[model samples]
Target: MLKGKTALVTGSTSGIGLDMAEALAREGANIMLNGLGDATEIEATRAGLEKRTGVKVSFMGANLMKADACADLVAATQKEFGTLDILINNAGMQFVSPIEEFPVEKWDAIMALNLSAPFHTIRAALPAMKDAGWGRIINTGSAHSLVASPFKSAYVAAKHGLAGLTKTVALEAAEHGITCNTICPGYVSTELVDAQIADTAKARGMTEKEVIQKVILEAQPTREFVTVEQISGLAVFLCSDAAASMTGVILPIDGGWTAH
Candidate 1:
């Protein structure tokens, strides 16, 4: 369905980002994978995706925390793939700590990656997408974007800012045939969450199992982690003709967490 189109999915070396990239690739979209990962492993992934999906795929190691680098990432994608028809702002970072003890540097890093990076990419990619008269911009937001929890001050603030950005861009781009939206997902079973579960277990003197149930998944009423495949499928649907009129929406794939 996406033949001749190009997509750039940040933080796509693994996890949710990778799943979305692969889904777009399966739909025949050329893929540009971005994020930090071991060189050999990332190359293997790039090659494997291309080989399996029979679509063009490339990798870029842009430091999304820097606005200039984020702009360059869009430019590099355009240079490699001709046009960025879909932009997935999936690059993100999270810092868990009380407001009183959250490090200043960590806050800055989270905001840069989670919030500002998307702004920079959208700014850079919009011109080409507008000229082409079509685009899809999907921001990977968190359940925290809709509701807050303690200890994740920076993360919550950044995601909320992203939600605002997605809405504003959607309004501006509506007449230009571009759709912008945020996907607010609940706790997902990504490697990042697994690590957080282990860390919380260690800090709270609880078993890993306990941390998952009582800490990581406590707010998720479903008590089940959202799967990467589910998130990727949502991205695919949002990019389709069926969703062209679905712009400016803050979609929740949070397993009923936001329903409450």
Candidate 2:
């Protein structure tokens, strides 16, 4: 579906990002994987994706929290691929604490990586996307983008800001055949969530299964976690010609988490 296109997914070494990268590759888009991880692991992932999907796959290891590093990643991707058709800003992390007790450093780090990095990437990639006359920019937001939770002030704030960014970019790029949208997901079975579950289990003296159930209960529709493939499928749809008219939209694959 995306033959000859180039797609860059940040923080793609593992978790949701990795799944999305593979999804894009399966659609025949050349992949540029980004993140900080084991060199061998990164290379192996790149090689594996390329071999499996028969699409070019490359890696860019950049600390996305740094503006300069983000800029460099954009430059390197453009240099290698010559043109970029898709940009998925999927890099983010969480630091949980009460707003009154939130560490300044943690707040700053979350803002840098979760919010500022996407802005830098969009700015850098816009010119190329605009010139191409067609592009897709997918920002990975969270259900928190619409509704906040306690102890996740920085994360919620950054996601809310990202939602705004997505809308604004969509408006600006509307005339140039570029579509910008945010994919807001609820709790997913990522390594990050696994750690959270473990922590909750230990802190509350509950079993892992009970911790998972409690997490689910927080949402209106208490059930399964959102799957990476489910989110990736939406990304694929957004990149398709059929979705040309969709922009400035927050497509929540959050199992009705925000509907309430």
Candidate 3:
């Protein structure tokens, strides 16, 4: 459905971002992946996706922590693809700490990646989207975007800010044949979440499974981590013609995490 479309997915070297890229590519969209990873591995990934999907696939390890770099990322993709049909703001970093104990640097880092990076990319990409008269802006929010979690003040705050940003943009672009939405997901078993499990176990003084059950999955009624493919599939749907009327939507795939 995305044939001839060009999509730039930030933080796509691994995990959900990677899955998002692959899913879009499978739908015939040209992919421009951005994130951090070993040089050779990223290249191999880039090459392999191109071969498998028979679509042009490129990679740039833009440091999304910087606002200017985010603009440069959008510019580079525009230069390569001639148009930016879909923008996936999936780049993010997490730091777990109580508000008082949270390091100032960590707070800045989380806010920069989780919140500010999307702002930069969206601002830069909007004019083009407006000119094209069609665009899809998908922000990767989390359950934290809707609810709070203890000792995760920075993450929660940034995600909440992101939700507001997504809604605002959607309203502004509602008449432009452009749609903006945030996908709020529950915990997914990615490397980032895996590392957090250990930290949470130590912090909560519980075993890994206990942390998984009592901590991570505590509020999730399904007791199951969301799948990367599931998110990617939803992303595809949002970019489809069927979703033309859906904008400013905070669609959650949280396994009922916010039901309470």
Candidate 2 C-alpha lDDT tens digits along 153-218: 888999999999999999999999999999999999898878767755665577988877775456
Model 2, residue 33: distance off in Å is 0.3
Off by over 4 Å in 1: 202-205
Runs in model 3 deviating more than 4 A are none
Tens digits of per-residue lDDT for model 1, 37-97: 8999999999999999999999999989888999999999999877899999999987777
Off by over 4 Å in 2: 199-209, 220-222
Q: What would the per-residue lDDT of candidate 3 be over residues 1-260, giving only the tens digit for each residue?
A: 99999999999999999999999999999999999989999999999999999999999878888889999999999999999999999989887666777899999999999999999999999999999999999999999999998888889999999999999999999999999999999999999899888877776678999989889888799989999999999999999999999999998999999989
Better of 1 and 2 by lDDT: 1
Q: After superposition, how far is residue 173 of candidate 3 from its true place, in Å?
A: 0.8
Range of the 10 consecutive residues with the lowest summed lDDT in candidate 2: 214-223
Please name the candidate that would achieve the greatest TM-score relative to the true structure. Answer: 3
lDDT of each: 0.92, 0.90, 0.94
Clash pairs detected, candidate 2: none
